[model samples]
Target: MHAITPYLLKSYKGRDTEKKESEHFDLSNIKGKDLLELLHKYMQSKSAHVYDFKEEKRVFKFSDIDFDIKRRTVSAFLVAGFYGVRSDIIDKSTGEIRFPKSESDAEVLRHYIQFTVPPGSTETIGLFHKSRGVGIKSLFDKLFKANFLLETQATLQITPYAHTGAVQEWAKGASVKSLKVKGFVPSSDITVNLARLGECNTEFTISPKIKKKGFKASFGPLSDFLTPEASSTQNEIITLLSNQGASVRTVAELNGARRTFEVGANSGGVVCDIPFAEGEDEVELKGGQPEFQSTQKWARSLTNDILKGVYGRRAFQI
Candidate 1:
């Protein structure tokens, strides 16, 4: 389960007459009592963002929603009577204008219940809404399962000080070629490499193919990997490779393999040449140990493993 933390805020449009009507209702009027009672009754609907209150200006609100992924659950506190959390906005012509960000919406509704409601309000009610709907439930289930629940570690870390000056310089469109590092001893020098992060050496060709049957492979632009189609294709290739005796290994193994192959033939009759490792006595094995003449041995072994059952099979007749 992946967890992504997002910032949440309150929903505040310009204060209007309707707000005042609810804000300063006259207790003397029977309609006010009926209106308050109606509001209390309405706050009973179930949703993650609902809450109940009983005070002198009972601000009826929603509860704090718990988005769960594993059990495919979305338990929300609903403000029974009023749609306090507007999921969608409609223009004057009734066409939807803006849609709420789910996490933000949940946070907004939560803030309203926690901070906006007046203290000492009487008979405030809220509901918890659970869905069996295919679409709505499916979406909530996915967010709860995929985005909110998983543990994610930061793959890259950057300090604020390192980029702050560079960002300021770029914003000003200065022709600054170097960054002056601020903090250090008088005689000690701190050099920051601004170009290293974005610089790409396009002088060499990038090979996308893997020669091993048990290994996975992919191609195309890096951004394409984000799409579902691309992901499916990657998964398919991985499955095929896994079934064919190829497997994903550590970065060290891949790096070693990259250096090992000079010229090789795959089971599909695809021939290619890989670069030779310089100065090393022999190629490094997938296990990270240096093997004497094991490259050719492993290549033959893998090829035999992949072509186990079809050695003598004839080609299809025309």
Candidate 2:
């Protein structure tokens, strides 16, 4: 089984955040021709996709390029690795070098990529998976920023699709009367009186047994945001967390609703595993082709499943 995550795509015109939010120009009636061309050039190696990683020169390559212009869907595989490490083998017995018999000795990392833009809609979703602690989303961000620019504007952005629906399900008709701080690390900018201690590290729990209390009442709007996926409340929380001058990790149990659940960093979205034959799912790079050659089909199936689960639409076949 393999996990796939979804992200929302947004485009901004300039550096003005307020104006960009007001415009909300996120794939709304986008022709997508220019973007498609850029991707084509990248896959063909006309434009190099290289990055420095741990003092090593790494190159990214895209293969199995499939797209549907009318449906606005693109699917490809991202293979990245260090450039040309081995060419020929050296004979230790005598001073001689010979060419390798096969090219399968080269090591590379791979991940599935899929993007879908609904017909004349503002919503766009890009499905990706992590490869060796790296994500293809970041590569796309750099790709667009370096190549797809519009007079120093038209920036491409990716916002993760949070699992707010799960939170809503747990919060509905349920009162979160307690929040326990597990590990609290103060930011360096802030001064804390540690007395004999050199640093400020604390663990505390705030539990109110009474319903409709102070902490509970003040948290109603955030609960509302989770229920409806409100962007305004989400932005406010983002600002508060970013500028809090401290790193806080909390764990709270949502009771009296459907079921109890935990909310934390990894609780942002759900991870689903796809059921596929092991051999069929694995993409072998023998002669630059897979042993089973079923990765593209697997990608299509997994993408359709995610689309059906998230957007209630399963018309994509590309």
List per-prediction Cα lDDT, in the order shown: 0.24, 0.48
Measured on C-alpha atoms, candidate 1 has an lDDT of 0.24
lDDT tens readout by residue for model 2, 1-318 = 233456766665435576653454546333344444444555555224534433345556676667667756676767666544556666866748865634334355666776776654455667675543455566656655666564224666677765443233333444444433433555455535553445565544444455644644323333442333535553454345534423222222343211122233343444312222234244343444332246555555544544554554444434
- In model 1, where do residues sit more than 4 Å from their true spots? 1-292, 312-318
Candidate 2 collision pairs:
none
lDDT of 1 by residue, 190-259 (tens): 2234334433212112235666798654353221121114347634543343343322111112222321
Once model 1 is optimally superposed onto the true structure by TM-score, how far is the C-alpha of residue 99 displaced, in angstroms?
Answer: 66
Model 1: ten consecutive residues of lowest lDDT: 1-10
Looking at model 2, report the run of 10 residues with the lowest lDDT sum.
Answer: 256-265
